[model samples]
Target chain A: DAGVTQSPTHLIKTRGQQVTLRCSPKSGHDTVSWYQQALGQGPQFIFQYYEEEERQRGNFPDRFSGHQFPNYSSELNVNALLLGDSALYLCASRLVGASTYNEQFFGPGTRLTVL
Target chain B: SQQGEEDPQALSIQEGENATMNCSYKTSINNLQWYRQNSGRGLVHLILIRSNEREKHSGRLRVTLDTSKKSSSLLITASRAADTASYFCATGGTGKLIFGQGTTLQVKP
Candidate 1:
């Protein structure tokens, strides 16, 4: 089965520009979560989407938002990005059914370079 | 706030040896998971131990969780050069998973 798939493997954007990343959850998964990994640091939780609604978010600012569609795909949007926004964006999916557990599967991630 | 913090910012070991990394958390959790990442890439899930459980083993990996102490340890036996990567501990706080700084492991063949 396909784990999790993310779009735009790499991107280049100027300051103050906006970027959108896409993710498709694994088969049978319903919950999608986003994370940002800075250089030499562990991944930080950005937000989580389930049932087409954002259920949890980290301490990040308002610039970061996400959406989950009915098909279990997710979109992560970053607005007015700054140079500090250069990092790797990762998407993770977890099953939410009777066979679901707390285990999470991650995608290859989108590398964003904000200059 | 983050819940988990791993010890020994970095570790270096020889092949065929065992490597142990420890992590400490600040709150109660449903489960604690261990993941490995190579060069800031995607994380590969290694193992997960529930709060009610004390220890678990999977292949060459072993995980131990102590709810009272709020800490966990990941032990990798017979390490190989390919095992060189950063290890992170994630604690499930309700619906969110909080991560730690992680430990960088370098195994030499």
Candidate 2:
């Protein structure tokens, strides 16, 4: 089966502009989590979507929001973007209702560069 | 917020040498997982250790967890050049995962 897939492998936007990144979870997986990885830094959890609902979220600002579709796909929306928001957006997929202990498969990630 | 901190942000060793990286988290967790990422690539799951488990092994990898201290370690035995990459430890509690800064390993030939 194919692994997790993220669209628009790379993106560029103005500081105040908004951007939308998409992710398709791995086959048979139903939970999708979004993370932001700054250069030379580990990924910071943004939010998690399960069963088309947000089940958990990190400490990110309200400007960052997400949506999960009935197909188990997900989208991350960032508004009023700041240069600090420029980072690699990673999408990880986990099994439906899988325990947190289970392993998560990650996508190649979408690189967002804000000017 | 970050849940764990990994020591010695970077490490360099020759092939056949063993590489060990440590990670320490802040709160109680249900389990901890280790992931490997090559430059410009996605993270690859290495291993997962439950809070109740002390240690686990897979191929050249060995993981040890100390829930009491909220710490864990990943050991890559007989390292190969292919093992050069960044390693991250993610601590999970409930349904959320908090990651460490990550340790970069350079296994030179």
For all candidates listed, what's the TM-score of chain B alone?
Answer: 0.95, 0.95
Please report, as a residue range, the 10-residue window in candidate 2 chain B with the lowest summed lDDT: B90-99
* Model 1: per-residue Cα lDDT at residue B1: 57
| DockQ values, each candidate | 0.63, 0.68
After TM-score superposition, the amount by which residue B21's alpha carbon in candidate 2 deviates from its true location, in angstroms, is 0.5
- Candidate 1, residue A6: CA error in Å? 0.7
Angstrom error at residue B52, model 2? 1.9
Stretches off by above 4 angstroms in model 2 are: A98-100
Candidate 1, A1-115: lDDT as tens digits: 8789999999999999999999999888899999998877778889999999998999899999888889989999999999999999999998766432467889989999999
Residues B14-47, candidate 1: write the lDDT tens digits. 9999999999999878888999998777889898
lDDT of candidate 1 at residue B14, scale 0 to 100: 100
Number of the top candidate by lDDT?
Answer: 2
Estimate the TM-score of every prediction.
Answer: 0.95, 0.95
Docking class of 2: medium
